[model samples]
Target: MIRTALWALGWALLLGGLLAATALLVLRQVTVLHTWHEYLIAAASFIPMLWVPLLLAALGLVLRLRGRWRLLAATLTLAVTAVTAWPMLPAPERSDSPQLAAEGSLTVLSSNVEYGGADVDVLTRLAGPEVDAIAIQEMTPDFEAFLAEAGLFERFPHRVGTAREDAGGSMLLSRTPLELIDRTEGTAFDNLLATTTLDGTLWHLAVVHTAPPQVGAEAWTADAAAVGAMVAPYTHGNLLLVGDFNAIAQHHTMRQLTADGSLRSLAAYGRGRGEGLWEPTWPVGHRIPPFARIDHALAGREVSGPRPVYETVPGTDHRALMVTVSPSA
Candidate 1:
């Protein structure tokens, strides 16, 4: 009876290992999930992709009694974790390309920089002369004073729009002399467009802070459509739309801007080891970027710029996106 029990337990361990492997690996590629189901699956996949490897190793310890099988189970578990959790992990080092810099690509940093409890000293330290233009959100009166003390008011001679204390107030700072063309108020949310001439070529920079996704799906839908309409006409020129878009890159709302054949900056330069593409820029000033890529710096084909720089900026929950553009480039 004792021997029979031992045999049964051994078989059970092997079976569990086989079952976990099959579920985690074989069934992952199935295409039966619908659109909504796919979204749910994507959301669900985000966590387990990190948990499964560790779980597998733990399970392997419980199930494997001997040499070869135990090693196999542990290796498989580690492999799974590496594939899923690697991209989500924090990349502390500077990941920008020197090649792109040598070619004179503009790197634009877009950061929310949370309104309350912001540190201007930290922001200034992070934002070196490498930054060409800054598009900021959540700039309170106090934060404005902070920037002024830091001498951003003088450094960036070209500017546009007032720093409104209200919800629609967004601010833009540029080194190039900029002319504020229009600040479109209340179609859905506030957006501003300014033009600067570089080497006789006119370039339009649209600074936007759209309604948050939590404001309601209908509001976001309308706001996104309006933003699309505003930028659609400028697709032929050197136009760049930058700011806290407050939506994911994959979301339907952001897709509207690229609908006019404009180039998405992140999608263009984001390559290699998943680090380039996983631009999670929220919950700023943290060790690891937040799980959503809400902020963006989008460029059209006519805009001659360098690769987009998504870096942690001073005093905000978002990173500062900086890009340098030249007329001849």
Candidate 2:
């Protein structure tokens, strides 16, 4: 009886885990859930794609199921795994000769500095002179001074936004002249808007950090949607938006905002090709590996950019995101 009970418990665990993963994947691919709870689930949509297959395979061996039963379990696992991974499959490289630095191109590095505690030397080293812009979220005054002292702010003299000692602060620094566009009012972190000439072409840039969904689903959605609407005008032209969104692309708000096709993310760089394609950007420098991508370098329709390059910085909770944007031919 004890052996039978153990077998039953194993089966239950296997079934439960797979079902939960499936639900999360579905929410990512297509979700109608709107509440904060649902939004939280959607944000975690990628975990299923990552672990379901491996976990199930391990469970199969442990369960010691016989012939047909084992075959059935394997088939079920494969089918579900494929479905979960479909949305993240590669979108194909846009350029064969992707340049690291180019004329008339704007390369930007964005980071959520975790209340100004990110490693100053490391961030400055990674963001060498080739980087055209740097967008910072959670820019406490101390962090601003740190970057300034490091000569980072000097590299891109043109700037917008302000530095506060709280999460609400944001800033954008550029190598060329920048014109200020009003920051979105009434946001946890105001979306900083500005424009600059890149190789003689005007390109709009937005440095954003949306409110975390945990604050409440309604607030998160409103913040996300408002930022999207505020930037709608520039979506069809030379535009760029970057920073920690606190919400992944799968969230209903993000999906709605990006549905117009102007905002494109290079998160699919290595999908299905044996490379680490689903790069996650949050919870870095934590007990668990960073597993969710909540930060981005979103490019506009008339603009193009390479897959975001991520690097871990000491003391920050997010991997810094970098990408270069140019006029698409």
Candidate 3:
């Protein structure tokens, strides 16, 4: 009876591991799994770490099995693991072309300050001479006050957007002069739209903070779609949309935002450290490594050499994404 029970348990473990791996593989490819795909994709970011224990369990089960069962388990487990792990592989080396130079570049930093909870010191440190502009979500009244007290306004003289008490607030600060554009049509969210010329090129900057999907599924979808539509008309020229999107790259809404192929993420450009793709930037306060790239800096083809650097902001749950972009000749 003991031997029979052990055999049954082994089979169950192997089958379960195979199924889980297959499901993740499918989820990585398909974006329309359901309305809950956002949450699932967010969870999928951790699959690289999750697969180790899964592989071990499957290998142990295979060792316990015999003959055809062992062979089948081994084949399925290996195949499934490879499929699920492919997306997380280190990115390839990028070319060292001179077109990617930062001589005529505009450096922008986008961060969610967690409603004034982020450390003022870290925030001030990142808003230095290298950064041409700074876009911040959750820019509450107190956060504005902190910036003012810390003399950040003097550093970045030109500013736009409103400071609210809620997470809907957003602000854009630039060293160059800013011209505020009316972007309040067909939306209830607080997003800032402004244009500034950099190196003789007119660039439109949109600071966005979409509604969290966990709060209201339908609203989150609508808000994301609306933001995409709002920016569609300005796809040409040097355009940038940056902020805490509250959605990862794999989320369907994120794909839709860049569906036109004109606007691509800094991650997509693969111009930063490592593979330069899928760097996580959220939940920093939990004392764990970030596992999703929700904050983003997206631009059109006119923008090139996007280098994204994620930095820790003390007291906040998000890592700041600082991307530098130069005009493509």
Candidate 4:
């Protein structure tokens, strides 16, 4: 009876692994799985450690199967592993061209201050000298006060957006003069639109913060799509959309934003110093490493040479995403 049970358990594991693999493939191809299926896939992409279950199932089959069946089971396991691992692969090397250097460059820093949870001193220290503009999310009154006390305004004289107690607050600070075009503070998403001149060339910048998906499925989907639509107009020109997106690259919402091929993620641009295609950038407080990269700096096709660098903010749950953008020939 014990031997029979072990064999049955092994078969169950194999069957389950195969089914999960099929589901993942289907999720990738279809867009209608907008509720739990979408959320689960997005969460799995965020915490890839979740793949351990499938791995364990594959191992069980490898141990239980015999002869040719054993070989077939091992192959199936390998396929599952490969498909699951594809999204986490290292990014390709970016081309270094003289033209990219010849064009005017803009350095922008996108950070989530975690509603005064970050160390103000660290932000002040990092923002000066290197950053041309700073896009911040979760800007509370306490955080604004800290920025004032730390003399961040001395470097970034021009500012926009409102400070709120909720996670919806957002602000954009720049050393150069900025012209405010539009601002939105809605229940779904918060955005600030402004334009700044870089070497006499005008470029649009959108500071965005989407509501967390955990709030509700409909809210999450609407928020992501709203932000995408808000920035769609600027894609034809030199634009930089930066903020705590609250969604990963694999999420269907994220895919919808980049579907038009106008806006492209800095990490996914395939030209950066980072090894992996995605850099984890949230939940940085408690000495625990971040598992998902929710913060992003996306550039339009006209923009080039955007190399993203991530830094941990002293007291916040998110790391700052810094990147330099330049014009493309």
Alpha-carbon error at 91 in model 4, in Å?
A: 7.8
Worst 10 residues of 3 by lDDT: 94-103
Candidate 3 pairs with clashing backbones: 284-317
Best by TM-score: 2
Where is model 2 more than 4 Å wrong at Cα?
A: 1-6, 36-65, 75-100, 269-276
Q: Per-residue lDDT of 100-211 in model 3, one digit per residue for the tens?
A: 4355577888888888799888889887667889998888999999999999999999999988887778889999999988464544457777899877778888998887
Q: Which one wins by lDDT: 1 or 4? A: 4
lDDT (C-alpha, whole model) for all candidates? 0.61, 0.76, 0.75, 0.76
Using lDDT, rank the candidates from best to worst. 2, 4, 3, 1
Cα lDDT of candidate 3 equals: 0.75
For candidate 4, list the clashing residue pairs, or say none: 284-317
Angstrom error of the Cα, residue 289, model 2: value is 1.9
The TM-score measured for candidate 3 stands at 0.83
Q: Model 2: per-residue lDDT, tens digit, 105-214?
A: 88888988999999999989878767888898988999988988999877888888888878888988888888887577777786888999877778898998988867
What lDDT would candidate 2 get against the real structure? Answer: 0.76
lDDT, candidate 3, residue 79?
A: 75
Instruction: List the candidates ranked by TM-score, beginning with the highest.
Output: 2, 4, 3, 1
Q: Whole-model lDDT for model 1 versus the true structure?
A: 0.61
Cα-based TM-score, every candidate = 0.68, 0.85, 0.83, 0.84
lDDT of 4 by residue, 1-329 (tens): 88788788887776776566556656655644644644664644534443555766886798688899889979977986886666566545545432233445788888888876788888887785757899988899889988998889888999988788877778999988989887654555468889999778788999988877677767777777777777778888888888887777766777888888898887773463454465678777656666778888888989875558788788788889778888775
How far off is residue 72 in model 1, in Å? 8.4
Task: Please give the TM-score that candidate 1 achieves against the real structure.
Answer: 0.68
